[model samples]
Target: MSTKEMFLTKLKRVIRTGFFNFWRNGTVSLASVLVMMVTLSVIGLISFSGAILDTSLVELKNKIDINVTFVPGAAEADILNIKQRLESLPEVFLVTYATREETLAAFKERHANDPSILAALDELGENPLGAVLNIKARDPSQYASVAEFLESGNTLSSGGITIIDRINYFQNKTAIDKLSALINAADRLGFALTVFLAVISMIIAFNTIRLTIYIAKDEISVMRLVGASTAYIQGPFVVVGVIYGVVAGVLTLLLFLPITYWLSKVTENFLIGFNIFSYYLHNFLEIAFTIILSGVLIGALSSILAIRKYLKV
Candidate 1:
């Protein structure tokens, strides 16, 4: 046979043998698929939980910002200059500048329902509000660095006068610190858990493959005795492993559909407006790719290693 035809013929034979082997060891194959399903499900749930945590944390982060209010008599040019300096900071996400007039207007609007406050403001006859710069950091952890930059006496305008009256970061200090710590902890814990689960799954699947290969040791010995090449001997088992992974991945996806749908409302309520089902549907392609690739690698690696000792025959 020509090389191409020989390769094609071997490929077909390997696939056919793989199917036969799968059905021949039907109960063991089923157990392997079920074990892989549990692994894939855990990975999928981790993705969902991570999404919910990230969304909720972002919402909370958005609500926290540093409010820098200049003194009432501070020059507008100086305030604008301070705003420019803050904008130059790499850690800063946004620096929203509100003129003194806009600040006064906003204050009045907020207290519109309170006649006493409006009357008190009118009695003053002068705008007590200062031009404000609302600073948002790119990350919760970066807030401290920005605060340090501010406190480093960079608030000095062209003149020797200190324009900044107060920064509200100290007020939100505790909350920001806690949030930063929580985000870091979540990231570390998520990575560790992913590694832990994947390793455990591979170990279980690897042992299961070993047991199946052990059952076929006699057949492998006969093939080895008949001068069968290593690749030829290993090809069918590899194909069978691939089949197991693909089936398990498909079943995992189907299984998640109903489970996510059932818990959609519960997740929306408890996970701070993030619906697990919605996330699953939206990120289906990415999730499927990850789970399927993981399954394939795990099964194929297990089979390749499992048959190593038997190949000596």
Candidate 2:
């Protein structure tokens, strides 16, 4: 046969052999597919959980208050000056200026349902609420620096005005710190879990491929005796492994939709305003690609290792 014909013949044979082995060794193929499916599912759940937690934390941070309230008589111009300075600061994301009137209105709105609070507010007979600069830091960790800048006599009271009052950073400080710590801890744990599970999956896949090879030992030996190349001996089993990986990936994607929908409903309040279903919809392609890539890599590597050991002749 010509060189091109010879190559074509080998390709056809390899494809046929691969399909034949996968069906003929039905039990082994099924087991490998199921094992990979479980691994993929675990990884997917971990990824989804981590994304939700991170997003929820961010939402909490955004809502956190670092109100810099000035003395009741502080001038609107002075408060605007402070707001501008805060806006210029690198650590600050936004600085909202609320006049005493606006602050009182908001306070009354929040307590509108509570007659006692409204009565108390009316009895006070004046807007005791002070002009406020509600500052939002670009990052939670920057809260300390931003608070210090606002409270320092230099940043806000630089115009020799005694218009400054107490800054309310202490009340929200603890929550922000705890959330930052939680995010850090979750990230570390996610990394460790991913590594641990990857190793476990690799081991399982390797053993499954090894078992398949063992079952085909006699056939492999005969092919080797007939001068079949190592590639020829290994091609069929690799094909089986690839098939398992593809099927497992598809199954993982199908399983993820219903599971995530239920989980999102259950954890809606816990996740603040984060909509897990929306997130999945937006990132579906990325998630699917990751699952398929991981499955294929694990499947291909395990098959290669197994065939190397058993077809060493």
Candidate 3:
């Protein structure tokens, strides 16, 4: 036979051997697969949870911002200059200027139905509101720093007089700081837990594959005795691992749909507008591909490691 024909013949034999071993070692294969599925499921659940928490936090942050109120009689030019200064800060996302007249109008609209509030405002006979700067930060952690900048130096003054009378971020400061800390702690804990679980799963998979290799030791020895190469001996086990990976990947993808749907409904019942199901469906292809790739790498690497001890050929 020609060299090309011999290579093709060997390839066909190796593939057949791989399928045969996978079926013959069905119990061991199933155990490894179950372990892999649990691992994949945990990973998917953690990822989904993290995404939901991140979205919720972003929504909360949008509702929390600094309110900078200028003292009565502050010039518009000075306020506008201060707004411009605030806009230059790296942490600032936006700075909106609301004149005293606008503030008065908004207050009146809010209290339009309350005769007592209307009479109180009418008795004042002048606009009692001050020019306010609504400042939004790019990150919650930067709110404190922005507030400090507003209170310090000439940034708040165009003519050397302190234009800013009050910086009202303290009310939400506690919550923002606490939330930032919580997010950091949760991230670290989640990452550590995921790593620990992944390591355990890898160890379990490796031991399972090692046991299968031990069972096939005699067959491997016979192949060696018959002058088979190491690659020929190892190819079947690698194929088995790949099969396990592909199966686990498909199972994980199927499992996430109903799981996320239920989670979405639960979240909406408690706190509307957080839809994990939509996120999962929108990113389904990417999530599925990632799980598949991770499984394949983990399985292939574990099998290679486990088989090395038994495959003397």
User: Best candidate, TM-score-wise?
Assistant: 2
Q: Model 2 over residues 1-313: C-alpha lDDT tens digits?
A: 9999998998899879888877887887888889999888777766787787678677777777688878898778777877888898999988888889999999999988999999988898988889888887888778889888776775545568667777778876776788778887887788688768867876877787788778778888898999999988888777777788888999989888887787777677777767777778789999999888888877777788877876777
Q: Is candidate 1 or candidate 3 better by lDDT?
A: 1
Candidate 3 lDDT, tens digit per residue, 1-313? 9999998998888778877877887898888787778777766766776776677667767788899888888999888988888899999999999999998889899989999989988999988889999999998779889988876795646568787778889877887778877977786787788778877876776777677778878887898899878888888888888888888878888988888888888877654577888889998888888788877877778778877876665
Q: Each candidate: what lDDT?
A: 0.86, 0.81, 0.81
- With a 3 Å backbone cut-off (N, CA, C), the pairs that clash in candidate 2 are none
Model 1 residue 73 lDDT score: 92
Highest lDDT model number: 1
Tell me each candidate's RMSD, in Å, in order. 4.4, 3.0, 4.1
Q: In model 1, where do residues sit more than 4 Å from their true spots?
A: 69-133, 137-164
User: Which 10 successive residues of model 2 have the least lDDT summed?
Assistant: 150-159
What are the runs in model 3 whose C-alpha is more than 4 Å off?
A: 2-4, 72-94, 97-131, 137-149, 152-160, 170-175, 268-273
Pick the winner on lDDT between candidates 2 and 3. Answer: 3
* Candidate 2 Cα lDDT to native: 0.81
For candidate 3, the 10 contiguous residues with the lowest summed lDDT are 150-159
Ranking by TM-score: 2, 3, 1
* Preferred candidate (TM-score higher): 1 or 3: 3
